[model samples]
Target: MRNFEVNGINCVNCANSIKNALSDEFGEIVVDLEKNPRVVSLNIDDKDLQKFTDELDDLGFKLIREI
Candidate 1:
């Protein structure tokens, strides 16, 4: 699984919104959000990383980190 950290995610609604947006592009993917660090962890393919980043950027969220 691949990992990514997204910024501008403030609440559960934001988490769900990201999940929904990712689903449209990636189908069934896993997203784990930790409020303390304000990070979003994703379990996805490496090739889809750019797509995911672009999609999030289009949706107004910025990716702060990736692994």
Candidate 2:
């Protein structure tokens, strides 16, 4: 799985929003609440990377960078 650091994620609900909104297209997303700023792990094609970031932004999450 590829991991990306993200902001605006604090609790389960925030994590769920990501899964609900992104899983179908991007595959399973694992959100690590234990980390400050949080990290979301998932498998995504490089071709879809831009779309993935766009979708996350639409859900109020900002993809800071890959970790």
Candidate 3:
């Protein structure tokens, strides 16, 4: 699994949107706006990381840190 901190998420709708967007591309994605340090976590192969990050970048969201 990977943990990515997302900034500029302002509302629940945005959270849900991100969750849905990521879900379409990855499986076992768990987006939590309610977390202390709001994060988007997912279980995906390493080969897909760059593509997913690119997709997130295209959405205008910064992928802060990957853990």
Candidate 4:
């Protein structure tokens, strides 16, 4: 699994939105809104990270970094 800091995911709705959007393509996703910097943990490969970033970008969010 990889941990990513997400920007613009400010609430439960946002977290859910991301989870729903990503779940189909990237299985077993976890969104932790309570964490500092807001984290999204997933089992996606590095090559697919950019695709994930793009999907998040479309939803008005960003995968800021892997931590």
Candidate 5:
């Protein structure tokens, strides 16, 4: 799994949208809007990271960094 700090996630609905968007492609997605840095965790192969980033970007959210 990878942890990514995200921005522009305003509410639970936004978080749920993101989770739904990526759920099919990447299993076990966790969107923690209540976290200090607002993190998203997912279990996906490294090769798919860019695609995941793109998907998030298209959803009007930015993935700040991976940890």
Candidate 6:
């Protein structure tokens, strides 16, 4: 799983919004709300990483870094 620490995920609703918005194209998305910056994890090819992050940005999530 590729995990990305991101901002703008304040609550469960935000997490769900991310999952709902990207899951279909990006596959299952796991958001860890317990973390300080929050985490969004999913399986994706390296070639698609940029696209994935871009999509997240389009949905109002900003990537801090990938883990």
Q: Local error of candidate 4 at 37, Å?
A: 1.4
Candidate 4 local lDDT, 1-67, one digit each (tens): 8999989988999988988888999998898978978999999888998999999999999778899
Best by lDDT: 2
Task: Give each model's whole-structure lDDT.
Answer: 0.71, 0.93, 0.77, 0.89, 0.89, 0.91
Q: Name the runs in model 4 displaced over 4 angstroms.
A: none
TM-score of 5: 0.91
Tens-place lDDT per residue, model 6, 1-67, is: 9888999999999999988888999899999999989988899999989998898899898999987
Which runs of model 1 end up more than 4 angstroms from their true locations?
28-37
Evaluated at residue 47, the lDDT of candidate 6 is 96
Residue pairs whose backbone atoms clash in candidate 1: none
Clashes of each: 0, 0, 0, 0, 0, 0
Candidate 3 per-residue lDDT, tens place, 1-67, comes to 6788877676788777777787877876677778645688888787998888888788767777875
TM-score of 1: 0.71
Q: Model 3: which ten-residue window has the lowest total lDDT?
A: 28-37
Enumerate residue pairs that collide in model 3.
Answer: none
Estimated TM-score for each candidate? 0.71, 0.96, 0.79, 0.92, 0.91, 0.94
Residue pairs whose backbone atoms clash in candidate 4 = none
Question: So what's the TM-score on candidate 4?
Answer: 0.92
Report the CA-based lDDT of candidate 1 relative to the real structure.
0.71
lDDT of 1 at 55: 87
